[model samples]
Target: MKTYTRITLSLLTILSLSACKNEEITPNRGKVKFETVSISSKLAGRIEKIYVQEGQLVKQGDTLALIDIPEVNAKLIQAEGAITSAQGQLDMAFNGATSEQLSQIDGQLNAAKAQMDFAQESFNRLQNMFQDSLVSQQQFDEVKMKLSMAKAQVSGLQAKRDEVTKGTRFEQIEQAKGQLDRAQGAKQEVLLAADERYVIAPTDMSIETISLEEGELLTPGYALFNGYKTNGVYFRFTIPESRIYDYNVGNTLTIMNPYTKDETQAKIIAIKQLAQYADITSTSPLYELSESIYELKVVPTSDISGQKFFNNATVLIKK
Candidate 1:
């Protein structure tokens, strides 16, 4: 019995030492994570339709949802009307008064010349009568005033006709052109706003969450969809200051999925100091709480397109 006890004690001691050695060689735990994204619109509207669901894979430029912004349609109509009015004004400036307008001015000038001729004849007759003592001084002066007023009228009409003959000024045409340009720019803005009504996927991604349901109001700058980039898988590990020297940026390492035993080669892309303990994603961290923690960002060295990855899943690194 004593011999058996001694042998069992020796075997237990060897097993204990082996367990300790394995513990000493264990590496820091890492977690798999993907690059996250949030998508929102610049204009506010009600959700009209949703084309994607959570966990759906989407392509770039795919329509994810439709927002009903009635105001955008109304504004578009207003912009079109403004463009029409501006175009009409610009055309008028470029093409001055029509032929009918010029003809009316000519007719008025001719009528004024006829009246002036009649007045001149009457004034001459009155002047001769006064010299022969047949007409009074008051009558001669009145006839002379009438002739002077008729000549002034003819001159004013001639000046008006000359002004009509001259087309619009350079400044007027420029002003009209500016108005048309402004209207065109406004219409373009409206068109862009209209496009905003359709929520589009900015890139290929996997939809993770939808913030609102159909018929819900989505405000400007509010995140409508939260997702992950399809090809942005990465690994993260938090190590203490004591172990940070074991890893460096650009160092190649092997990462294993603890659950599936799948392994992949990755390169350390960054080493950053963790400012907060809450940022640690390691499982069962054994480092002292007082020790400064650092993060290791690792990316796959080769293509990971065929591998399946999950966010915050457990992975391991062997030093």
Candidate 2:
């Protein structure tokens, strides 16, 4: 019995020593995550030609597709013709009447003046004869009527000649010029429309998805392709809300790959204020907790030219 008690006490002492020497195990750290952005089109039309293929890389302003432009080109041609005609009309209005036209008006004015003079002479002769009792009152009245008709004809001719000599008025010339300008502007608009038929890349990005095919009709604001920058690849991670005040923009941090234990450096690019919430009953381990968090965007110092990390890649971040 004494031997049994000694053995039990010895085992208890060994268990106590082992428990004191054991170290606490640390919990595994989690990575940050972010939502992705998809790019879409601003204008829609039939896809005439595609300049890029699946998984192709493109730079900003690079032509990605060429839409049919026959209609727009035709309109542009029509606008050009209109502009030319309007310009010719404007020029004609600004220039005065030709020398031949002025000469014709002058000839009419001279003829009118001659007729008036002849009528005046005849009237005076009849008036004197009547006073000397050499002509009847009826003859004097006829001469006076002929003189009045001649004066009216002279006045009409003078007014007509003035109008022809004046050519176009300043306001008329200005109106023609305005029409020409409008035609020119229309031509420019048609040209711009034609240019818009060809869609180009907005930035140096990779083709994430292609939603349309050649000959497909698309409307404005349609999604034709999705793209993202290849070199600007970033990783987003969230820190606890309690640590939100510890970071700011342009702050530097170290990042590690949770799976491979590889380490890389990064910087804080932005922080979101809204709290992300998830249902407690949800099975998604990613959003098990509903709490406010600080979003951190970290970009690699070197170009991630050919690397494609998986979405929601687990990473370790350290200040």
Per lDDT, the best of the predicted structures is 1
Q: List candidate 2 segments past 4 Å from native.
A: 1-44, 103-160, 163-168, 259-262, 275-290, 301-311
lDDT of 2 at 179: 90
RMSD of 1: 6.4
lDDT of each: 0.90, 0.75
Which candidate should be chosen as best, given TM-score against the real structure? Answer: 1
Candidate 2 lDDT by residue in tens digits, 1-319: 9999999999999989876644221122445443333554555568888888867878888898887756776888889999999988888897867788789878888988899999999999998899999999899999999999999998998887787577788887898989999999999888788778878787787787788889988777777877666555677766677667777888876666656656666777777775555566377667656657666677776544444465566766643
Each prediction's TM-score against the native?
0.76, 0.66
lDDT of 1: 0.90
Q: Residue by residue across 88-177, what tens digits does model 1's lDDT show?
A: 999998888889988888888899899999999999999889999999999999999999999999999888777657888899889999
